[model samples]
Target chain A: MAVALAALIQDPAAPPARHIAVGAASPIPAAACWLVRKAGANVRLSLLHKRRGNPFTEGTRELFDLAGQGRIDLFFLGGGQIDGQANINLIGTGDWPGSKVRFPGSFGSAFMYMMVPRTILFREEHSPRVFVPRVDIVSAPGISAPGVYRRGTAQALVTGKCVFGFDPARARFRLVSVHPGETAASVRAATGFDYDEPATVEDTPDPSAEQLALLRGAVCDEMLETYPEFCRRVWQREAQERVA
Target chain B: MDLLQLDALASLVLDGATVALPPDNSLPSCALVRALIRAGRKNLHLIGVPVSGYASDLLIGAGCVASIETSGVTLGEAGAAPRFVAALAAGTITVLDATCPAMHTMLQAAEKGVPFMPLRGIIGSDILAHRPDWKVIDNPFAPEIDPIVLLPALRPGFALFHAEMADTHGNVYVGRRRELATIAHASNRVLVTVEQVVDFDLLDDERLAPGTIGGAYVDHVAIAQRGAWPIGLPGCYDFDAAHFAEYARMARTDAGFQAYLQRYVYSDAALAAAE
Candidate 1:
């Protein structure tokens, strides 16, 4: 129950006058939604609507507001595939033939990469397959700083095991930090291409008691409680099947 | 909350609707299914967009009372679920079409309670034969409209959603325009479970979730947190992988399901949790 997001802050006390946190908010939008709840100051979300193909339908305007004013400072995203330059391919890479892989689409990754001052990319699976060097496509550019991108694009990358930085100097992704149990080699094993600096990745801090409490107790209880019903149809159905 | 008490909730589905899930999932500890089961109902169905990780598969298996199915793929991207894939491979279950975009149309149609939907001609090549359930019905009423492909509706008698929070009477917080609401709206009745009740104005004073679901639509309102487990509850916790995997394995066989129910569900634990 350690503080999963404390490290997300740059200056906890005198936080940057401006910043943004764009949450993926998928699988269960609530996962990223919870993170935004903690980092509320400069955060925006790319919410999936009740209907697909109807973009910007639900809260599209709010997203426009957050990015429109450069209110968001950081972007956090996670999916199945990520390549060097931080191009992500959540769409299929291996299984599909000419059709290729399919993702939830880029969602607001394209916009966030341009609008947010800093962006961080993370992967749930820190394996070699998911961590590619060059992505199949650019969901969002990692080092899209000036001339390269429309300027003002991604700044950093984070994963379950480590952290990475975008070196505007070299115009590429560079390993910045690693979590406690991870190693540079293991981290690289998951990544696809070569980033700039191989030597200087640091370690992410452990989750704090306060962070854990906030994560568990501070959520909106009304909605949080109903999740079991979701599983009842999925997990419990099978649980009962195994019994009778 | 203690997860062991979850089966109390699982025992509620109509008899045939019970789908023994894979062993690799968590068994919820609540009353959602308890109410469903006691009614001795069946004809369970599932159709929604997609969840990020394992929630969709988990729900497709457990939440469904009669048959386990969905409209989209969640194998990281667009594709059939492993259960569906393997079922198609072994011929345990009949797979209609492996296309996702087309299925999205079907889900949209079903959600809208429509007879058929016009697709993007994706079925012209390979998927038409794959899906025996779908039919190309011509529209005599409108000659301009492409001969329509009608996918049957997957209408679950009820849809259950877990939200960020809900007012005591049950208007879901629209933190995002979510697929859950669509599923609920598409179905006959909705059951809404939330994290907890704020003073209503105590949070979302502007009514962030104002029109998401009317109080009348939601049959019941539950207040709980860490409610979306094995499914992932945002910052609260990552998915419970071990539990999820365990459920997946146990549910691989029909006999295994009976054994599961006799052990965990029929016990006093389920009865107590229900109480």
Candidate 2:
């Protein structure tokens, strides 16, 4: 999943990303950014959660200032609920002031979604519940109406099941590819919003042997500083093997 | 330099005052929070710099906060902040939902002694729509450029936090957590609890001078060892994972939350009295 996300980030059609910033509590994105750096992409990787790796001395204030100045090329965001129009809800489920279920409050999701040119919406769980017809609350609307100053919107949404390419022009998602085990029909059944899809969907390319080795080796090691627990749970064997 | 008892330091915050707390996973002044809870402070408006977790939840659960202004309040790896979730769901406390940079920018304005700070990147968000205090206006410098949102300055009545060490001169050595310095400069009163008080001047060391905040900004200092317990102090200790897990488990319901307060908070008071 991290390798695939990295590939999306490195795609030439996207912005020539010179600098990428990963948010707090997002290990996968952090891993992806590290992988891109290891792959010799000439990208400046900034992980907000990293203890020693963070370049900013003043904290996230610098990150926000840079993004506002259009320095950040790619950023990642996730939501409790994401709708067809690309509206994300980080607030909670149900109405305002009276929510049925509450997730964490919107930290920088809305701000980064507006300022960063390419914001990828990545949610591991892709079900009817998560991909709603319309988010209960619009923490950050994917498509701003004319006259609202918005530099960007959702570029793509990568979930566990499949990757959906967002068309800002049409304001809809287009089925790109399904993961190894999942079928197109299964992806459709899981998603609640309407999207454009071809008759046949291709399988997302598996990571090359070199990519896997890099991920299991240097990438995993670099991730230890920010995501020690995650690395312990996922790449324990690789880390142990390196130690031996 | 003024050194006050924990009770007197906590009393610096009166009812209906807007207070700013540090962000999640930093030094949260846990000892001071307990003192406030014991003193029964009420109607306080709490501001979380970007995010808040344990301290915010504990205060809301204890009914000490009338309103909360923050990005999010979660216990991080321990999971949902149960008391905070319940408070929002029940609509018991007024919530002014804000994004991370918005809070920082507002506080930065206060630090700069500016009436308002113009920030980019909130023009299309629901956060901008919800905050009537935030305004979007055309750029005076470049009329052709896109409009930007301006955030009013957030001048907190008090900046309450915990640090690793403070010297006899009341200068705090916060190391790389410089945001604490910003919070102190932004607020009218800065009260800090530290693990220890040193006799030597902290600024005398060239290595630590850049990270040290001068005594002028700090109004009061108290020595409270393990002051940020449960919430980790950067280099001092790790978060009490088991205790946080227990908090997440027990704070699910109102009765359970109150029981938690009675056990940890008041019980500590009782133990202190006995001692």
Best model number under lDDT: 2
Model 1 CA deviation exceeding 4 Å by range: A1-73, A89-93, A96-118, A123-127, A133-153, A159-163, A166-172, A175-191, A198-244, B1-45, B48-59, B62-158, B161-258, B264-275
Q: Could you give the CAPRI-style class of model 2?
A: medium
lDDT of 2 by residue, A1-244 (tens): 7877898898889878899999877878888888888888899887776655357777567888889899999999988899998988888888763278888888888788988999988999989999999888878889886766778888899899998999999999999999999999999999999999999998989988988888788888887655666777777742234532
User: What TM-score against the true fold does each predicted structure earn?
Assistant: 0.44, 0.93
Best DockQ among the predictions, by candidate number: 2
Fraction of the reference Cα-Cα interface contacts (below 8 Å) that each candidate reproduces: 0.05, 0.67
The regions of model 2 sitting more than 4 angstroms off are A51-53, A209-217, A232-244, B268-275
User: Each model's number of backbone clashes?
Assistant: 88, 0
RMSD of each: 12.8, 2.6
Please report how far candidate 2 places residue B106 from its true position, in Å: 1.0
DockQ values, each candidate: 0.05, 0.60
Question: Which docking category, incorrect, acceptable, medium or high, applies to candidate 1?
Answer: incorrect
Estimate every model's Cα lDDT from 0 to 1: 0.46, 0.84
Per residue, candidate 1 scores C-alpha lDDT tens digits across B48-166 of 33222243333333333323342233433122343433333343332222333343444457678787665422222223444577786655576454354566655555565555556
